[model samples]
Target: MTRRDDIIAAAIRLAEQSSTGQANLSVRAVAKEAGIGASTLRHYFPTQSDLHEAIARRYMHVAINDFSIDDSARDPAERLFECCAQLLPSHEHRQIQLDTWLSAHVNGLGPERRAPVRRLLEHSHEVTYDHLDRWLQVLVDEGHLDAAEVAPSSTALFTMLDGLALHSIITPERITVDAARDQLRWLIAKVLEPKS
Candidate 1:
């Protein structure tokens, strides 16, 4: 592989394997893993933020592309649950990813590094929100949810997802992935249930 590809692969490996996530990513470390000098790696990514942006873009791309609900499933509620489940940090690896990213955002190397990390964090949340909005809209169209509930429910769902992620990261033993999924489904069911 080329030097650039090698650097990216090394970065990805660190991000995927480490609990601290991309916060643990370092030029010297990645360069060493890629069998290159630090200067050479710097040539490709002059700043830590540049490397972070690349990792964030690639990671988010894969995450979004990987989130798939089997279209063959006839039930819209099931599909919605699947969609939300896909977005949750339900697994150890996923929780690590979210924690690592959030940690970097909060404790970035410096202002220079923090800006790109901020952008990455914001972009990821927006991507998640967009996905939820689409799922909620689908349910609304099917008459399972009210049209007016879309805006409020979207915010609520996103908040719940974020809360779940935080609890998963901070107190994982307290909230298993299955429990989190069940709670998410309950929220959806409660919102969609008809009132007298």
Candidate 2:
């Protein structure tokens, strides 16, 4: 692996280890974890936001690859659903991730610290949007969606998926795993609907 990959791997390990999530992923800590000097890490990731973006992208890549989205034997809609479903955490992992995110980003903070936390949240949203954008682009390329619809479609789809994921985590009794999947499938159908 490249040094850059090594550093990201170290950060992922630390993130997985910490209950506080990526909020506690300080440069000094990541550098030490990677067995590299702070200066070396900076050379690869000049800023905290850059490092966070890379980490988020890596997580999404791994998550997307874990599913059989490439299996052409499955129906296209099913394949699309699987691709989008990758964005949502599985039933067993949802609560843990939600709890970690809350503890890291939202649990306790004054106005003074809100700015940095807000930046983190924005970066997280952008990463999610970016992944959705790519997935939608593929559908567009395959004539399943309009090329012009990507921006709005990605935004709307991400919003729904984000809400569905959070609700499923917070109130599984109301938004059961099957219910969330049904909602996602409905949203995908709407997105794939041809423009009038």
Q: lDDT scores for all predictions?
A: 0.75, 0.76
Runs with alpha carbons beyond 4 Å of true place in candidate 2:
1-6, 13-33, 37-74, 101-113
Error of 2 at 161 (Å): 1.4
lDDT of 2 at 119: 61
lDDT of 1 by residue, 1-196 (tens): 8777778888888777776523468888788877889999999999987887887766775676323333534566677777777767746576566767468657544455666767787778787777777777777766778888888888988888878877877777876788889888998787777866
Residue 58, model 2: lDDT of: 77
Please write out the lDDT profile of model 2 over residues 95-182, one tens digit for every residue.
7765655554562243455554566566667767777777777677677888889999888878887687668667879887678888
